[model samples]
Target: MDRSPFPHHGPLRPEQVTGRESLAVDLAQRIADRRLTALVGPRRFGKTSLLKRVAADLAAVGPQPVWIDLYQLTSMADFAAAVDRGLASVVGPVRRALDSIAATVALRIGVLGVELTRSPKYRPDPVLSLRNLLGVLTSAAQRHDLFVVFDEFSGVANIQGGAGVLRTELQHHFQSLGIVFAGSEPSTMRALFSEQTQPFFAQADLVEIGPLSDAAVGHIVEDGFETTQRHTGGITSRIVAFAAGHPQRAMQLADALWRRVEPGETADMPAWEAALAEVRTNVNAASERIFSLLPTGQQKTLRAIAAGGSIYGAAASALELPPGSAQDAAEKLIGNGIVRRAQERLEVIDPLLADWLCRRFPI
Candidate 1:
């Protein structure tokens, strides 16, 4: 009833009644026991949010919690620098624990001569720097039991095989430090951690986050709209259905609808329609950028698959590309996390993304 549709920043908490309490508690227990955990889900399904909540709960018990988003990192050095920055921000005992490493590592702020008041200079290798930092953290954890959550872990894939190496090293050196890995790209993360060829194979418990239930979605919408005196009705239901239980989309749509509501006026169907249209537009822009990066044959193959409503051979001949080309492109799309294949049928990962592909490709 705060008149704001936006939920709290970071992650939603367990008691938030957002319908992820069971999973949050499960993750909390795993971290508490010093177990590594991987939380995987489609984009905006609350993977990061759930992990943030778990981190908060863990912090409440003892060991300080540190949250890092790998997406913001481009290389191992960047990741290490980020870890240093994140750890330096920790206060009290956690801050003191990092002091020694910070001195030895000589961590700095940036290219400009900015030093971390009590922090160390930035190290060149993030994995090694993190390894050394974890050594200090492990010693501290023995006294305080720290929890570290790495969000958007899928970005580690972009780190030139550093993902595999980092996972292996962390598993070896920091088993005592509680670790929670969360990523929007579940399939990619699974391949990294579950695939036998990868370093993290079966190294951590895998937690797949699915869509929220109708009741949970309803609660979030109702509570969000309550501040504006808007009753939960068809409008909320339609929004939820449109989001298809995606937590990020649901929150985003709610935020949009709230902004559209005039003072003392309830949100109407037109507002929902307008919001969906905007979402579609944004999705289209993103998809177009990705599609443009593909080769001509790959683009044609995608269109053909979209037109045929499947990736099976029936559509191959129409695209004028070789059957193998279409199949290969399909694999590439799936591997790049741009498309999803299930039951031998291919579709864009998100509904909004699918709508964009349908509009641009127009098969």
Candidate 2:
């Protein structure tokens, strides 16, 4: 393909996706066993790309798989329409039933969109429509071993009573179909399935997507540069380190660097600095906004973590945070998706972000 191996513009194409062999095997196993699985992580960490890749893999084999992006849904009608569209390819009674429901549901759109009209004998309320939709979807999958993937599932939680409604709908007969839910928001995704009083508590297996290895990302960047005949001594690894193992950031920084150098030329400090500056320009505003919203304690904790200090025990003293507040701050940061538990200590999720914070509020 005539594209950067390290993608920056958008989600990676199937051919460009790399370094996910182990994750793919685990996902395939879960699908084969028909277990409800969730892929959870911070935003921009390639969760959607991975979900697409896995869904595409299964669809290529046999049983048809349907992918619904919940981010685009607004009302219950949108939800019902999504499920109906997904099962349109099924044959016989289930397909007919889904068609009937679609025909009955009152939905309309016009230019800026073409007009769509449907008429049927009976129409159900939004709540019952959702319940019935799941019922028919399960029926459709039973006749054909189906895989249904809900991407950006975290968006559903934003709708009023959405979690409860979904839990009720799928409680009875979802086991027949292989389902995977993918979301970028870690805290909300965890709460949906982990809270004891919640409807889906302990229902799906949680797959936490951690940061990529510096080595893997570094290799990808180095290879991309070399493919373009642009050489780099250690600028590539530095980019990986600055991105803090986040795949998208690493790829993005690498892609930006590639553009600054010409073919058959070496990428020196000037090219590296220019690339880094571009990343800073693009990411600084958002990083600053996120940092500004934190309270004094969290801001202190963030600075400590961003500065790469041992933020667990005695290191709290370095942050000038009172004893035990560091832990609380760490928890808050984790909940906010600003940082996560690494091998032993907590680390900021985005290295470039850490640099931004460090430069903003020097500790």
Candidate 3:
């Protein structure tokens, strides 16, 4: 059985990944210098894959990577558990250091073998367990570089004082550890790091990841088909044009097209159409949910942006929207990471969402 070359799910390794060479190099360099970095991007923008690439680069020389996903953590205990999961990868002196802390916190080695626990006495300390866990890692970092990456870090806001605890701990550990904080929600991440009143205000350097370049998108589509011994039949250009450099969309379309074409078969326009239909079907629910949750003005603005070309002018007029309303809504969407301005024209950042809007409502 010939498997699909495009992987749209989970993190891709450094060698298997494409379109982020410069970013990976720069990120690794910064982290190697013991800089605290904040990686900000929209959801499904391949931040994890890029992080993996950076980790791999740093690993070859030094720096052990500890990765934690904070996405559904609702409390400080949950945060402590997630930290433990990341620390499970640590070994040698660092592992011993964690073990020492584990004893003090009455950390139990459960049947599951997860060693992160908070003692009853310290449970009232809010995120003190987390602070202890990080303290161990940072102390270990004084000898060996520890690259700590917290993905979906905006969830820190969910815990009562998780952000405050993290900020205070990080201030003392800056010179000792290399840290990278990443989150999918641009609005929340901005508030966490950019707002002066927020605990993480001005704590780390900001790095923004956007859509892939056209050449990178082309490379993925073309290389996948060629490596599988399947001909692209000039459909690569069409896929590239539609994907507009969104990594997930490019891989999704490529995967769909690869499935449509048999071994030794060439991909054609019909294959492209079928693949697009499949993708649209899969994403319709999400697109609908996003659209339904938006305010009236923003919904109209999305439609206008999807229609393309002068969203505040002709598109707004065609959508029966006042220019001021459309402009204001567009600005709000941009701020929320839903839309972006490219070459003086506003565009829906998610290509599939824009495609859904175009198909469901012409204009």
Q: TM-score of each candidate?
A: 0.80, 0.85, 0.90
Summarize candidate 2's per-residue lDDT along 1-363 as a digit string, tens digits: 245556766577765666787887798779878888999888878777877777678767765566667775666655655554555544554456455544454422111011111332334355565665666666556566677888888777766676677777666656777888888777888888899977778999999777777777877787888877778767876887677778888888888888877777788898888888988999999898888889989988888888878766677886788768878888888987889888887788888788898888775
- What value of lDDT does candidate 2 attain over all alpha carbons? 0.74
Q: Of the candidates shown, which would achieve the greatest TM-score relative to the real structure?
A: 3
Please list the residue runs of candidate 2 whose C-alpha ends up more than 4 Å from where it truly belongs after superposition: 72-124, 311-320
Instruction: Indicate the residue-level lDDT of 200 in model 3.
Output: 82
Give the Å error, residue 205, model 2.
1.0
Worst lDDT run of 10 residues, candidate 3, spans 108-117
Give the residue spans of candidate 3 off by over 4 A: 91-93, 104-126, 309-325
The C-alpha local distance difference test score for the whole of candidate 1 amounts to 0.68
How high is the lDDT of residue 81 in model 3? Answer: 73
TM-score of 3: 0.90
How far residue 20's Cα lies from its native spot in candidate 2, in Å, is 1.0
Report the C-alpha lDDT of model 1 over 1-363, residue by residue, as the tens digit.
Answer: 354665634565544535888997898888877778888776667777677666667677765787666775676666665565566667876677567545565643232112222234552445555565555555556566677888888877777766665665465545567888888665678887888987778888888787787778777887877766765446988877766666776777777787777656777888888877876766676777877899987787667655546545666777776788878888877666666655566765565655666776664
Give residue 95's error in model 1 in angstroms. Answer: 2.1
Query: RMSD to the native, candidate 3?
Result: 2.8
